[model samples]
Structures are given as C-alpha cells and as structure tokens.
Target: MVRSRLYKVTRGTLRLLSRPVRRAQGRGGIVLEPYRGYGSCDEIFLIGRVFRQSRPAPDADRDSLRDLWRDVGRRIARRAVRGAAVTARFGGTEQRVATDRDGYFRIHLKPRAMPDCADPWRAVGLTLDAEPPVEARAEVYVPPAHARFAVVSDIDDTVMHTGVANKLVMLWRLFVEDAESRTAFPGVATLYRALHDGADGEQNPMLYVSRAPWGLYDVLSEFFARHAIPAGPVLFLREWGLSWTHPLPRRAEDHKRILIGNMLALYRDLPFVLIGDSGQHDPEVYAEVVAAHPGRVRAVYIRNVSADAARIAEIERIAAGVTAAGASFVLAPDSVAMAEHAAGLGLIAHDAVATVRAEREAAPPEPATGPLPGVLRPTEVPPTVVIEPEGGRRL
Candidate 1:
C-alpha cells in the first residue's frame, strides 16, 4: 500500500512536470491509435487507444542524437483520453466499447461472415463517438486454415540482448538506447524465419511475447524491423502498473501462462512451439503449460542464459517432466543448436541449419570491454544435451 501510494505520487509529479512539453506537441481533436490485433474466424479481438492529438504519427527514426531525443519526447508526450466511446465495425458486425482509465479500448466481435484467409490480415474500421469524430483501421491477423503450428517466442533475452534480469540495465537498454543500437541474438532472425515458413512450406503464425511494458512497444517494433525478425500481429506486453505494491498484474509465470493458454484456446487445432530464456521464470511457466495441455506443445526451447547451478538443475528437472509428457525440451546454447534440433524434428528443413550456422558465424563478436562501473554482467551456463524419445520426430 505504501509503495503504491509513493509510486503514484512520484508518477503524478513527473507528469505534472512534463505538462508543458506535452502541451507543446499539439492541442487538437481526439486521436485513435489502433494496434495490430489477431484472432480466429469465429471471433475477432481488437485493441487501440484514444488520445488528444491531431493525428497519429510514426516514431522518429533514431539514427541521430536529435532523432533519439525527439523519439523519446513523443513517447512520453502521449496522454490517454479516458471514458471515450468507440465503435468497431467489420463484415456487417458493429460493437461499441468504452476506453478504460488508461485510455485503452478492446473490442470483441464475431463477424457474421468468415473472412477469406487468402490474406492473413483483415481490416476492421474504428470510430470514436466524439466531437470532430476520429477514425482508424486495425489489421487483425487470422491464420490460414492450413497453418501447421504456431511459434510463441519471448522478446527480451531470447530474441534480443536486453538485460532483463537487472531492472536498471533493462531500463537503460530499453529507454536510453536507440533501435539501431540494440542487438538481437545471432542467427535468431534466420531460425525464426525458418519456423515461420515451416518444413512443408506452410506459413506458421509467429507471436512474440514479452514481460516488458507497453511503453516500449514502438522501440521493440522498430528493433524487429531493423533486425528482420518475423513480425507478429501484436507483441503481447503487459501494462506494468506504477503501483509498487502490485507492480505487475500477477506473478510473471501466471501472466505468461494465461496468455499462452489463451493462444492455445484461440487456435485449437494448432500445436505450439514455446521459446524463452532461462534467466527468468519461463522454464517453470512453459513447463506448467506443457503439463496442463499434454501433447498440444510440440517442443520447448529455453536459451541457456544462466550460469547458476541451482537454476540449471531446476530447469533440467523441469525438462525431464516436459519430455516425459510427450514434448521435446532443449536448453540450447545458441540459435544454430535450436535450428539443428528443429531440423531433426522436421519442424524446419535440414538445409536451414546451414543458413542459421552461417548467419551465426557472420555475426559480429560482442565487445571485450566489460560493463561500466557497478553494472552487472549477464551470466550464461553451458548448454545441456537432451535425449530424444524414440520416434520423437513428431508429437
């Protein structure tokens, strides 16, 4: 309770201090910022935000110091307009919803007509029921009927080199650094592309999930575009509250498990390949999801990011259970290692392994200089070998 109050007061003070800068940005009509959404044919889910602005604009390119400053200012200047009435329309279906306290609105509509999956995204129109009525369109990804499997990957340590275990380091990397300055794990883009284009040439759905807050969405989106990582309709991020007493909605494990569960339910016919790093609670969360759903998970990949003996041992035990429950669990040392295993399971083509290895070998080596004074360095454990079950080529 005390922490929550302190955090709220501190945030309020900061917002008050920035009022002039925000006001300088604009003083105009309402703006509807629609984020990409996804769902199946029977039901559609869409989310967006309402703000007081002339129009929506892309974040500034961060190639220069001035550009970086402008980008940061734009992000901070966004102020949500609460209690706005919004309507979503698609295929003769119209639904009304109101913005929450944070100026965000979510719409759930079951279209009367099934959308053609010839294209993955179907557009939905959005209108704000306000003066000078604002409007926007959202793209919702609906996978083809033939999608063999889906890939859900973590964003922080798994795809990019964000020091998430250390709060200060993570914040510095997220807010202070530009998109071009951020680094993705070597060959991660190649491996993810292979998974996205499955062995049979089916376009599998790739969804990125992260524990990072929504404030970093634009930066992360730019990071993916800069690095050529596979794009998902939406990057599932939490609104990490300012309330210190309840900083996050729930334990990280439960929050992730619930999201994965929702995905499983949304795509009932597709088995999932779950990917994350060992630095956080992903092993436990992915293990729980695998155990609960049994054979619905085709494989589990945990990047070897922790040198802690206890953590490694715990993950190994968890892996044993996940394997016993009919899923392949690999604590991979690098992107090529996971690529090789995916090839063995026929998830990706055997030739893709060479491509991944080449990409990995071509990546620049990390700088030898250590972190600045008092900065914590990341610890990584060696990869552990996994014994595949007999006839484990498919689930």
Candidate 2:
C-alpha cells in the first residue's frame, strides 16, 4: 500500500513539473487519438482518447528497435485526459460519445448491415470536435459470416520474447528494444497469418491480448506490422496502479480472464483458438475460459517457455480437463507444432502446417539465452491494477 501511494505521488509530481514543456508541444491543445478496435457483425466497440496532445508524433518509419526508441524519446511527455465530443461513422450510421475524465472514450454500434462479402475489414472514421479539431481512422474486423473460428493470442513470450515474469528484463525489452531488433518467437507470425487467412482463405480476425502496459502501444503495433501478422484490436491490461492508501486490483490472472471472457461474450457464436505461453498464468486463465465456455474454445495452445517437467505436467492437467470439457489443449514446443495441432483438429488446413514448418526452418535461429522465470501460477500473484495516477503520481 505504501509503495503504491508513493509511486502515485511521484508520478503526479513529475507530470506537474513537465506540464509547461508538454503544453509547448501542443499537448495542451485538443486532439483525438484512436487505436484499432474490434467488432462483430451487429456490434462494435471503439476506444480512444481526447486530450491535449502531450507528445509530438513519431516518425512512421520507426520499424526498427533503434528507430522506434527515437519516437519513444520524442513522446516523453504526458497529458491529462479531458472529455470531448467523439463520433464514429460506418455503414451510413453515425453515433457519438463523450470521453471520460481521463480523455478516454468508447463507442458502441449496431450496424444495419455489414460491408460487401468480398471485403471483411470495416474502416471507422473517428473525429474529435474541439478547437483545431483532431481526426483519426480505425478498423473494425468482422470475420466472414460463416467463418469457422477466430484466434485470441497473448503477446509476450507466446508470440514475442518478452520476459513478463522478470519485471526488470520485461521492462527493458518492452521499452528499449525496437521491433526489428526485438525477437518474436520464430514461426509464430507464419502460424498466425495462416490462422488469420485460415485454410479456406477466409479472413479470420486475430485479436491480441497482452499484459503489456498501454504506454508501448505504438511499438507493439509496429511489431505486428513488421511480422505481417494480421492485426485486430490490441487490448492490454490496466496500467500498473501503485497506490498506497486505497485497495487496488492485483491479480494479472483475473484481469486476463475478464478480458478474455468479455471477448468470448461479445463474439458469442465465434469459436476461438486460445494461444499463450507457459511463461505466465495463461494456462490457468485460458483453462478457465475453456471450462466456463465449453465448446466455444476449439483449442488451447500453450507455448513451452519453461523446460520444466512439473510445469508441463501442470499445463497438461489443464489440457486434460480442457479435453474433457470438449476442447483440444496442446502443450506446444514450437509455433509450427501448434500449427500442426490446429491442422490435426481440422481447425486449420493441413497444408498450412507445411507453411508454418518451413518458416520455422527458414527463420534465423533464436539467440541462445537462459530461460525466463517460470510461468506465474494463479496463486502466486496479487490483484491486477489499472494505471491511474490517483491523487497525483509522478513518472
């Protein structure tokens, strides 16, 4: 409690001290910022911010680790979120919503009809009505009406090499490394592309859920682009709230479970292929999703980050239960293996397996390194926290 409180106070102090510099950069000016959002046939969820622009835009060419850091350095300031009139227009329907005090706004839509059958991606135009108006565009991916299944993947370790259990190393890789220099698990991109484009070549949505802080949103998005992985909504856990006086949510597991559950609920009819690593509580979190929403999860794929026999057994136990509950639970050693498993389950095309295998074979070898800390157990962590500098916190 004391640590969290002091953390907030410190961040608040820094923000106050940096206000002048940020204002000079037009952060004090009105702006509208939106991230990629997701939706189903009838419904859409759009999230974005309306605030004074705190940091100047970074170079769009920042696709490498070093170049990405250049942009990160440029965006060193922060701004307070303040409300504004935000609007979303699609399928001839326009709806409006107001940003929260934090300058975050979310809009929900029920389209009268979707786009033509040939194109599955929907473009949503978002604009903030304020002085010197700000405008941005976002996409809403609606998989084909008869799409067999969709994929929900974990970012760190599962797809990318983020040492989530080791906070210090995770922070370094998360912020300091650029996408080009940063390592994504070999063959993972090819496997994901196969899933996104499916065996039948139907465009299936790939939504990435991560425990990563939203501060690195740009870098992560760039990583996805470089990998040629089809992008959908990038949802992250609440920012870390280090508050001392009041209670805060603490379990990363709970936050993950809730988010995954919400996604399942939103796309009620679309079965999912859940992928995560053995590096964290994904096995437990995803297992719960499988048990709770039986049949909705077609398969649970766990990347083996730990070579530990006990951990494998634990995940296997969950796998067994998931199987009993009518889903396939795979203890995957590689992305290509998971691709093969998906194929065996008839979730993906048999030929896609060869594509993923070839990528694994052709990709450069992963630099030899020590294993990351063991995947966190559900019982081993505190509550999940959403980062909000309550009562003034400094960076």
Candidate 3:
C-alpha cells in the first residue's frame, strides 16, 4: 500500500512538472501530427505525433517561403522530437502519451467500459502547450452494431484525379495547388457521403487508406473536409528504401496488405467496402485483401481510371474473386454506377444515385491532359516516384 501511494505521488509530480508541449516562445514551432484511428464500443486506438518544432535560423530571413529550396531546407532543419506531451480526450477519459525519439506516439484508450455515443464519429481533443495554446483533434470512428459496412478508399486518381501515372504532371499539379485548388473527382463527394450516412441515416464508419506517405496528412485532411467526404481516419503509409547511397524511393504492395489486414483484425465483425482506382494496384492489392480476409469485405469498388481493356479484364477477374469470397465487387467508371451498386446492396439509399450524378455534373471537369504515355499505370508497374496530392513533391 505504501509503495502504491509513492508510485501515484511520483506520477502526479511528473505530470505537473513536465511541459513537453511548450516551446521557447515562437522559437520552436509545434505540429500536432494527426492520423486515422479505429475503435469498438469498448476501446479506441489513436496514433499521432508531436514534432520538436522547426523554426527558421537567424539567417533564414533572406530566404522566401516560395523559394524552390525552401521546403528542402525546412526538412533538413526539422527533427523527430522526443518527450512532447500529447493527449487524447473522449468519453470523459483522457489518455496521454509522450512522443518518442522519432516524434511518434500512440494511444490505446478505453474511454469507458460501456459509455454510449450517439454518433459513430467522435472528435478527441489534442493540445500542445503554447502561449496562446495550440490544439488539434483526431476523429475516432466507431461503427454501431446495426451498421452494415465500413468504407476504405484511396485518394489519388480515385476520388481526386492527379494523373498519378505520370510523375512530372502529378508533381506540377501537387506543388501548384492548395487544398481548395486541388480537385475531387465529380460525384465522389455525394457517393462517399451516402456511404457514410447509410440508407437509414446511421453514420457508418469509413477510412481512407492510401499508399501515399504520411507527410501528406495535412493537405489530404483538408481536401476530405473541403470535399464533404465522409470524415473518418486518413490512413497512409511511408515509402521504404532510402539510404545514403540509394536515393530512389520504393513502395511495396505488402504495406497496403498489412494495413488492411490490421483493419480487418480490429473489426472482426464489421465488413468493409474497399474503394480505389485502377490507375494503381488497388485492384490487385484489394483483391489480396479479399483473399486474406474472406468475408470481412462487404464490397470492393474499383474506379476505372484506366480505360484499357486488359486492365478492365483484370479488375473484373478481381471482382469475381471478391464475389467468390462472398463479397460483391464493382468496376465503375463513374460514381453513379458505384452508388447504384451500393444501393442495390442496401449499403446506401436508392435516391443517392441521382445525387451523385448531379454533383458530378455540377463540379468542374479535370484538365484535358490525361496520363502521359509510356509511364506505367498502377496495374502494369509500380511507380518509382509517386507522391500524394499534398505534403510531398517527390516520392
């Protein structure tokens, strides 16, 4: 009993004295890293990071923010940062974890053993100790028992057309556009929202999983909010194979498979609807997911970014595989078709089909330039230097 009391006292003292989130009065800039998290009715998993803060040097006054080298210089200057105070609060329970040396942190919290939430989505508050106070929040998606399915989607070339198959074009568009300037594919917003708000208006959980790196978190998050897509966790991956000598980045198919597998593990009872574009290996990757998880996936929606016949045939075969595993799959060129299929499955409302068509007609069309010739699409070959819509220039 005496030792327990001492331990409690020490913990309280450390919590009071440490100011991990505070920086030296504008000298160090703080960034609260945000990522998507999943949870059941009993517990939630939250992962985020707290940067040590990157500030310009005294000599950086001469450099312009728009300078070509500015982003590189900033990256060289920043550090992963350790010991930062990060917090996640929800359901009357607040959990805290400190940033590791790599500036990453994870929170596994049970807000309550049995507390009930009215909506499937919950915003957990995160804060950094600043003079004016710096705060960020992450949304934790919890599907209700009656909810039919969850949605997992990819961003580039699927919902938002970036011409990702072509490196030069993808980079030019990514660097030039801000979140508002970046475009979403027509009708995607309506379809996604319908999936989020199901047939009876029960907000089913959704997650956006991308082969894009974690760096694009800020821009991608903004795009989702601006587009009015069903808000959930934005899941991303980091590229491997960057050494002192080998400078080129490498993306692996297994990274996607692993993340999706983890999601399946978390919600064993919940079925998912996988959505991605054919411009990349989404069909193959998601097919592997269906094979691995069996019936955990309720549906697979492959957006026909590449109209090539062979690619179409491959997707159809994958769809067949998914159906064999007891889930429906769709290879749709437009959002309305996918919406129609979703409605047929009782995943969304029947009227959502018209809403998707209207949204598509109302939205501006993408630039005339399609993917450049000779560069491989996601189905034929993996990209050597693919980047997301935001947060990165080179892969």
Give me the candidate number with maximum TM-score. 1
Clashing pairs in 3: 280-378
Candidate 2 stretches greater than 4 Å from native: 1-28, 54-74, 115-117, 240-254, 368-395
Pick the winner on TM-score between candidates 1 and 2: 1
How many residue-pair clashes does candidate 3 contain? 1
Report the lDDT of model 2 for residue 335.
81
Name the TM-score of candidate 3: 0.75
**Superposition error at 189 for model 2 (Å):** 1.2
Indicate the residue-level lDDT of 376 in model 1. 33
Instruction: Tell me each candidate's RMSD, in Å, in order.
Output: 7.3, 11.1, 13.8
Residue-level lDDT tens digits of model 1 in 156-240: 8899877778776676565445566677888999999999888967778888887766555666777789988877855555664
Q: Provide the overall lDDT of each model, using Cα atoms, as 2-decimal numbers.
A: 0.74, 0.68, 0.67
Order by lDDT, highest first: 1, 2, 3
Tell me how far the alpha carbon of residue 103 in candidate 3 is from the true structure, in angstroms, after superposition: 1.5
Sorting all predicted structures by TM-score, with the top scorer first, yields: 1, 2, 3
Clashes of 2: 26
Candidate 3, residue 231: CA error in Å?
1.4
